[model samples]
Target: MLPFVEYAAKGEHTASIIWLHGLGDSGEGFLPIAQELKLPDDLGVRFIFPHAPEQAVTINGGMVMRAWYDIKSLDLDNRADESGVKASAKAVEALIQAELDKGIAGERIILAGFSQGGVIALHLAPRLAFKVGGVMALSTYMCAPQKLVDEAVQPDLNIFMAHGSHDPVVSMSAGQLARDTLQHQGYQVSWQDYPMEHQVCYEELVAIREWLMATLS
Candidate 1:
């Protein structure tokens, strides 16, 4: 199993959020964000943050880092390492199964990620055997939209995608394109944008918090 950190629910674990970090980051990367969320104690939502496996990233000059996939180029379409991505998807699938093994219903679990992590979340969420609670993608682009329709058991699974207006790393256009693609292909998606660049902001966090409440309520 991939290494992970957990934030226990106030009482029993009635729901869970398996969150992934951006490239070169680990499980601890998003712990502060989860803490800052300070979800109501009654929600009984456990948060699981998983560390991406370390691999050589091509865009980073083959420097080894904790990345969901190796980025081959800056181009959104050609950048993804498909093989590595599928592998990590399998790893994440195991995490989901682990949650199920512990008794959380598939619909009570969510998949969220930032940047490269978001790419994987969008990739695997729809294809799972059970319809997951939701998908949250931040500052990331979608991959292989062509395959999603054919593979998805629940094409309309709720999705929340947010991006920065001035993001140089992933580009706002990429996020917009992803939202359009998902919407056009019949997915329920909520879109948001901010004035920042390639990072989360307070406003985005507020929206996310609200989304979480609505999802778990």
Candidate 2:
């Protein structure tokens, strides 16, 4: 089971958002973003933030860390965490199901994340059995670009990806690659680049709010 930090809007549940956070951070880390979005007062959108399991990070040389999966190496040039990819995918699947149990339909829900969380959102959004409202990936990249076409388990789902040009952690190329891959697969994609680092900017937040209002309204 996955541990989660939840924020429910006032009134009945009309929609829901499942947010995932990056590595080394807890689910609570992204709660402030949810609050900032100020989901429509009457829309009743619930935000769910799930914390990844704690385990030794191979990418960090087996250092005990709170990671979605294990990284085999830290070399940015050769960084691909296979274990982390699979584990996080499974956790996302479970979270989706949990939301379903709460009566939220797939298309009424949104999956979003930042950095590492963004990676998971991109990886799993396409594989969900039911179509989701949309996906928002901030300052992140797809873990394995090559497998996206084959492993995807759902139909076309709108995707919004934003990355900082000066991101020192996950290169801007990663986000570009994800956009190219998804577009090549005929998926609806909205890609944006900012003049910042490995973090979200106010402009990006504004773009996100606009996208959410347009897509989920």
Q: All candidates: CA RMSD in angstroms? A: 1.0, 1.6
Where is model 2 more than 4 Å wrong at Cα?
A: 74-78
| Per-model TM against the reference | 0.97, 0.94
Q: Return the top candidate by lDDT.
A: 1
Whole-structure CA lDDT of model 2: 0.83
| lDDT by residue (tens digit), candidate 2, 25-108 | 888888898888766877778899988888887667678867776657545434657666777888788888887898888888
Lowest summed lDDT over 10 consecutive residues: which window, candidate 2? 71-80
Candidate 1 per-residue lDDT, tens place, 37-140, comes to: 98998888999999998888888899999999988888877887888889999999999999899999988899999999999998888778788999999999
Error of 2 at 134 (Å): 0.8
Q: Which stretches of candidate 1 lie over 4 Å from their true place?
A: none
Q: lDDT (CA) for every model shown? A: 0.89, 0.83
